[model samples]
Target: MKIGEIAKAAGVSTSRIRFYEREGIIPAAERGANGYRNYPADLIALLRFIEQAQHLGFTLREISEVETGVGEHIVSCTDALAMLAKKRDTITALIAEAQDRKRRIEALMAELEANRPAPRAAG
Candidate 1:
């Protein structure tokens, strides 16, 4: 598939694909007639994975490192799993904290409502 087609199918722009190519995550595109870029069909999946990883809080530099196995494989599958577990735990903790906060706020609101002056009926 061509770059534009891939971008449209991926719901991304051509410049984004070019940027990813420049970043070395996606493989370089093959140039066709008149300097048009021809990307492999499989790249669409790779690009979507990149998007998903970014959404999961993986930095581009980190993703690049993970992709290239750079600096002696600092990130392993086990390590990634651990990190994800920790993130999940943190999210769960935050939910609990939010629930507590919500309870306090609700209680405070109820107290205020109970203490408020009642409306006076018109004569």
Candidate 2:
């Protein structure tokens, strides 16, 4: 398949595919005699996986690191799950920190309000 064909099938832009290739997130496409990139048909599935992973908060670096028989995106569901769990843990911690900060801010606001002085009467 051509770059545009795969991009259309993957619901991503052609430049995104090119960017992935450049970033080593996906294998580089083979160039044809006419100088057009010829991508493997299986690449569409990989592209979709990449998009879904990004949507689920997986970084490109993380996705690229998934090891398979071919060395990327085939042999390791466990690795992907581990990455998901790690991301979930990070997000959970951030949420807890944010809640703590909010509680402290609210308490400070109440204390300041309670200590505020009465307004002076108009002259």
Candidate 3:
């Protein structure tokens, strides 16, 4: 397919597809005689995978690791799992920190409420 067709089918802009090719998130496309990009049909699936990974909070670097693994057969399930476990731990810590912050804010609100000043009598 042409770049425009693939971009439309993949629900991404053509520039984004170009960016992915440049970033090595997707394999470089073959150039036609007119210098237009020619992408494979399977490119849509890869784009979807990237979009889903991003939605799951994976960084572009992390997505690039998976992309490179799929493209080059360099990463094993064991390696991927180890990475996922580390990400999970990081996310867990962040959640805990957010909860702590929320609790502190709630406590401060309660204290402020309890110590509210009495209203003066109307003149």
Q: Which candidate leads in TM-score? A: 2
Model 2, position 65, has a per-residue lDDT of 79
Estimate the overall C-alpha local distance difference test score of candidate 3.
Answer: 0.82
lDDT tens readout by residue for model 1, 42-83: 676667766776898767875675532333333468866776
Considering only N, C-alpha and C atoms within 3 Å, which residue pairs clash in candidate 3? none
Provide the lDDT at 52 for model 2.
Answer: 88
Which segments of model 1 are wrong by more than 4 Å? 5-33, 40-42, 54-65, 68-76
Candidate 1: give the clashing pairs.
Answer: none
- TM-score for each of the candidates: 0.59, 0.87, 0.78
Ranking by TM-score: 2, 3, 1
Ten contiguous residues with the weakest lDDT in model 2: 67-76
As a whole number from 0 to 100, the lDDT of residue 56 in candidate 2 is 87
Off by over 4 Å in 2: 68-75
Q: TM-score of predicted model 3?
A: 0.78
lDDT, residue 103, model 2: 100
lDDT against true structure, model 2: 0.86
Relative to the true structure, how large is the alpha-carbon lDDT of every model? 0.77, 0.86, 0.82
Predicted structure 1: clash tally? 0
Ranking by lDDT: 2, 3, 1
The residue-by-residue lDDT of candidate 2 on 1-123, one tens digit each, is 998899998899999999999988888889999999999888877888888889988788877877634434654688767878999999899999999999999999999999999999999
